[model samples]
Target: MHDTGDAETTVILDNGGHNIKLGVVGAEGPRLIPNSIVKAKHEKKRVFVGHEQADCSEKFSLFYVRPIERGYVVNWDTQEQIWEKSFSKFDIEPTTSRIAYTDNNYLIPALPDVSNEIFFDKFGFQEVHKASASGFVADHAYKIRRERCACVVDSGFSWTTIACFVDGVLIQESVIRIDVGGKALTNKLKDWISYRQLNVSEETHVINECKEDVCFVAMDFEKSMIEAKKRFDENMIEKRYIMPDFQTSFRGQVKGIREPLASDAPSIVLGVERFAIPEILFNPSDIDIDQCGVAEAVVESITQSPEDLRAALSENIIVIGGSSCFPGYRDRLLQDVRSMLPAEFDVKVSENVANPETHAWQCAEKLLEYPAQVAWINRKEWDERGDSLEYSRFFRTTVTSDELKATTQEFEQKGEKSPKNGEEEEF
Candidate 1:
């Protein structure tokens, strides 16, 4: 950990599929901006980015084109547009500030090249460091109490991943990814609502809002399902969500169960959909995906690590990201993980109650208080070495793409099939 006192300013960017959390490193908190460029059905000519999207007159039927897909930045042009807005709106001078950006661990193979092109060649930043957001969270844990071993369950918009960190370094072999996330949950809810009440397949923006406002993980799945099946009037599970007029409210509001009225605007009665959507994270097989759930993924990921570190990892499980904000999620995950583990080994799961979605950004800010010159590359160094600069200096993972490829090939040749559709398998 080299001292970075010479750097005048530091900027932290916790880029996610749904929202981009960014601000000056030392600021009290980070500002969350929409990570996509959106186009509303009512407003065709005007494109909304970041906070501008919130100002759209009609949020319903809004179509979004995001730079990130499946947690990886695939479209640089759109990503650049979003970044430009964020930087300008935040009054950040890229060339003068040291930038720290978060990338998904699975995308590390391509991130270095893309990151170099963007921050160094394009924006001309003074210095840049790229690391997984989970790595930063783990580092923050180590910073506060010197906790070295932990498992991170990051349930974001595009995917939910389980990663293990030992001594602030991520163990690549102990990483597992489940394709179920907020977007999938939203889509599932949309399908359920469309099948039962209204056709909302195209109303992604509205459906997503509904999910955030009402969805929760069920502590007891069977009992919740029983309650969901009761009559709307007698059922405690049912809640009426008043659809936004768009002309006035611009966003829908969740109302208590009520009788239909002529004056009442369009609405949907939400019941099982609330817990059913999030249930996919606990049981991916419900949606026909063969991958294990978050708790199972955590267990599988920890099994890949050294025997001595397993207990520490299980005892320090940290859940983060927007999806983790759902009510009962933390408790339910803890229950499931606990049931799967031996009674002798204590299992503890924790989440940031105040700002779980931006925990990574908060951790990144805390990380800046320590020495970090070794973790960042300056413009002079970038210009001299180009892509030859070792990414391990900035990234915590030491595993190479080629090495992983060879390992996968060896597994395949040995008649063991790799997980399909990029789903992670237990090592």
Candidate 2:
């Protein structure tokens, strides 16, 4: 790792569809700013960003827009607006030096295999380092806890990526990506509500509200679903959510009403809303995939390591990302891992130390604290490394299964790991 100098402020951007988390990275940790690009419809015109937009959601018919779809920037224009609004919050000029870190999802478009010397030119970031979401999660966890080996199950809004680490560095081949995420779960809720109510617009609002207030992971899916299907009263179902104004005011509170949208619209109950989230981790098949569950994915990722490293890997299972913030998520993850793993394996999840979403950015700040290390990265270095080596070879995996298996075995035997993987892990 290289550093450039005394970074007055390090900007870490953990962009999620649900929330775009930003914070200053320093000696302390990532200072989370609870704001994002999804502005309230009324505030849409103004260059609003960060936590400020969150307060204004109710004022202007808050029309939330996410430029990122499944971890990549699907709409750069909207994303540019989001970044502009976020940067304006600092009250700093456009000339400020910044270190920008983003998830590996960048490989999708903006930072794809194509060599764009203009990336630095366009974004004001003096130093930019992009790693996969799981890689970033593991990197930051290693910094805070000093755990050498672990599996990072990053269940974020758009996608869930699992990454493995050895001695603090990510093993590229051990990375796994799944199509399932909080968005899918939210959409599923949307579908479920639509089936019962027949109104997409109103149902979308309810689904979003339910996701914010009631959604959580279920440690025991079969048992919990049976319980969730039981009847419950409105008093027991009501949840107080602090509503934000999208125009002028900052905050307010409103109880979620499963009230019938129209005279004919079916009323939504809280039990079903809360029950849908955790099901994703256990049943990707619910969304039509025959793949393994998150815990199973973690176990499979760790199995790539040497037998001696299994305990170390299991002990540092750091859960970071937007989806991890759902209520009871950590407990459910830990419980699921415990149920499936050997009795002796130790599995741990990250706490709300630096905000679950920004932990990776905090880790990047620690890495860029030294100016000397920072200056080492230049376009020249990238040019020297070449596209095939710097981007293609690392980001794109087109190898055969037999070759992939051989490589995985080779890494295991060598006690080495990289945050690179084949078809099973395509984050």
Candidate 3:
């Protein structure tokens, strides 16, 4: 994929089990070129990935290949193909620059508990940044200036990650993880529908469709279920949504047909009752997890930090990741957190100003704002060091006070000026 005269860029990739998001960090923002690859069986093999693969699937038998499963990359060969093809689309060169230098760093979330050897060796990233650390770094970028503590509830395709951020940095020890995520939810919903409606085998593509179309988090479990169970009424059903036509080369209308149709497309209810379904984050057991929801996790993490810090934490609750965008998510998360917190605690979720799917990338971009970011490894430095432990120094700064303070000192002494402090540093 290397070609001379193309712009050199920094790549940020998040390898989720459901999808892979990659883009170059730039002035406009992180340019996300989705690597939502998937497994497919075709009569003849012709490589297509990301947008192209999506496009080709319309007229060809090419199957989408999702190479990651349950937060781990299952097929390195396929992943490599996806990355090479996807990055090539942007005209980004592979030749090493100072920015792409051994020190120039490529940041990606190494989904916790997964071996990153292949990612480090294959993707040409000197370092495989931990996803948890990246999440915290992202939280810090938009960290509200606040005295309260807040919890981060990251609900995504493979896992629902819960972590507590005091001020803006993550409390590493307090971080928690749940096996459930959008995938599990989708499967559960698919099982429900298959048992009740369709008897088709669960395919990733079709199940993903069902998830996007029919599945949603329930805020008031019993109440929402009661409402959903009531006899179908057009008033009770949400507006119908039609899947866009992929049959043609052009973008054309795909009308949403209503059910019991002589003409309309089959539709399902979403947001059946206002603020009802999205509340499941606080009450996981309702989904049979036998686990505490995100709100409770925040409280527990905060209490573990210090009972006195609870009020402070609640004031800065930052919700990012894909799941946070579920309608009524913010209101319900805030409400539930408030209920668990002391009467004096103040809870607020960040307002939606951009694509929630890209929040992590946004957070990664915000790292440029830090006044002291020595841990912010550049491509050249990464090459020189070639040491995981050295990188760990930067990683620890994200959550450890001692490391953060040391990093601050290093930045100050290196003559790297800070933007916040009006220095010449170009972090």
Residue-wise C-alpha lDDT for candidate 2, range 312-341, written one tens digit per residue: 677667777776777777787777777777
Tell me how far the alpha carbon of residue 394 in candidate 1 is from the true structure, in angstroms, after superposition: 1.8
lDDT tens digits by residue: candidate 3, 326-367: 666677677777787777665666553366566665555554
Error of 1 at 357 (Å): 0.3
Q: Lowest summed-lDDT stretch of 10 residues in model 1? A: 418-427
Best by lDDT: 1
Best candidate according to TM-score = 1
* lDDT for position 154 in model 2: 76
- Candidate order by TM-score, highest to lowest? 1, 2, 3
- On the 0 to 100 scale, the lDDT of residue 254 in model 2 is 39
**Model 2 accuracy (lDDT, Cα):** 0.57
Ranking by lDDT: 1, 2, 3
RMSD of 1: 7.7
lDDT of 1: 0.79
